[model samples]
Target: MMRIWPVFRRELVGYFATPLAYVFIVIFLFAMGASTFYLGNFYEGRTANLERFFLFHPWLYLFLMPALAMRLWAEEKKTGTIEILMTLPIPAWASVMGKFLAAWAFSGIALALTFPMWITVNILGEPDNGVILASYIGSFFMAGGYLAIGSCLSAATNNQVIAFVVSIVVCFLFTVSGLPLVLQVAQAVLPTPVVSAIASFSFLTRFEAIAEGVIDLRDVIYFASLILLWLGINVALLERARAG
Candidate 1:
């Protein structure tokens, strides 16, 4: 825990030490605001629900979360700092947890910055704050899951651009698995139950429930399990790399 603190601090500080954090925040807010206000017609129609805003999150995170996580291990390896980092007195899992938490928290801040849209809804009408809160929680967990995948991929490569691209591809498939395009493709080659089972693994399927104000325990557990599983893989990859 103590070791984790320093690592967390270091990673968190690293996020703000460059233009990446600010650039990401600005673009995130702009895209979210534009989607909700302009494309979603929230203001023009004066709808109180956050449906439009929440709807855009999966697509938004599909790209943005990977960008946020691309540097976790890839940059370390590219700079030849992976060895130095691994040699620290901290446990590998602790380091992984700390870095994961830092990236997750950064994504949380970006998500939180969308609160003005919430304020807009409340001022327009009586939006359910409970539902809004649940959506935010679900979104954060979804982002964490993506970041965990990115972290593992980043560990497997020494190029940040490659890490970012691979993470985006993997995360895109995860988000779209439940969509008609992917489901249709799966149904053509697989049994009905198998196709349904594969779609059930989609991030969108779980997020839709939360966006609608229902926090199913299964969805929460799924996201948590995803993060843990990917982080475990990330640690193993790094350990293997260290050994080889």
Candidate 2:
């Protein structure tokens, strides 16, 4: 934790040192608000819940998370500063976790700033705030999962565009894994257990479970494991990249 702080602090500030942070926040806010009001029929539906708001997150993060993750390692390589940073007196794990945590925290900030929507709902009528809070929690974990994936994919190449493309493709596959259409295809050839396994990997399934106030331990564990698994891959990829 001690060794990771400086890197975390540096990376977090780096986000805001330019217009990228503001741009990201603005885009996120616009997407959320527009999706809720237009596609979700926020006014027409007489409800105080943010169900419509949260529902669009998986699709929203599909494009956004990769954009955030594409620069983590890709920019380091592009500018040739990765060599200096890699040789510093820091554990590779520390570097990996620090960068990832910084990115995750940035994601959390973006999510938190959407609280106005929550506030708007409360003013209109009584809604279960607990469910809204749980949805926020689930969304952050899901963002971490997406960012970790982006981190690993970014490490595999120095091209940010390529990193972004690969991360989108991978995240999309995970998001659709549990959909009826995907399940239908998997069950056609795969065994029952294999089909079930594919369904378990679905981000939408686990996220919806939490968003609906079903805070089961299994759903939480699934997101945690997803983040850890991809982050471990991130560490391994960075180690190899540093060596080469």
Residues 13-127, candidate 1: write the lDDT tens digits.
9999999899999999998888877777776666788988888888988888889999999999889887788998999989999999999999999999888888878888998
Candidate 2 residue 163 Cα shift, in angstroms, is 0.5
Measured with C-alpha atoms, the lDDT of residue 216 in candidate 2 is 88
lDDT of 2 by residue, 25-132 (tens): 999999999999999999999988999999999999999999999999999989998888888998888888899999999999999999899999999999999999
Runs in model 2 deviating more than 4 A are none
How accurate locally, in lDDT, is each candidate? 0.91, 0.92
TM-score of 1: 0.97
- Candidate 1 lowest-lDDT run of ten: 38-47
RMSD of 2: 0.8
> Which segments of model 1 are wrong by more than 4 Å?
none
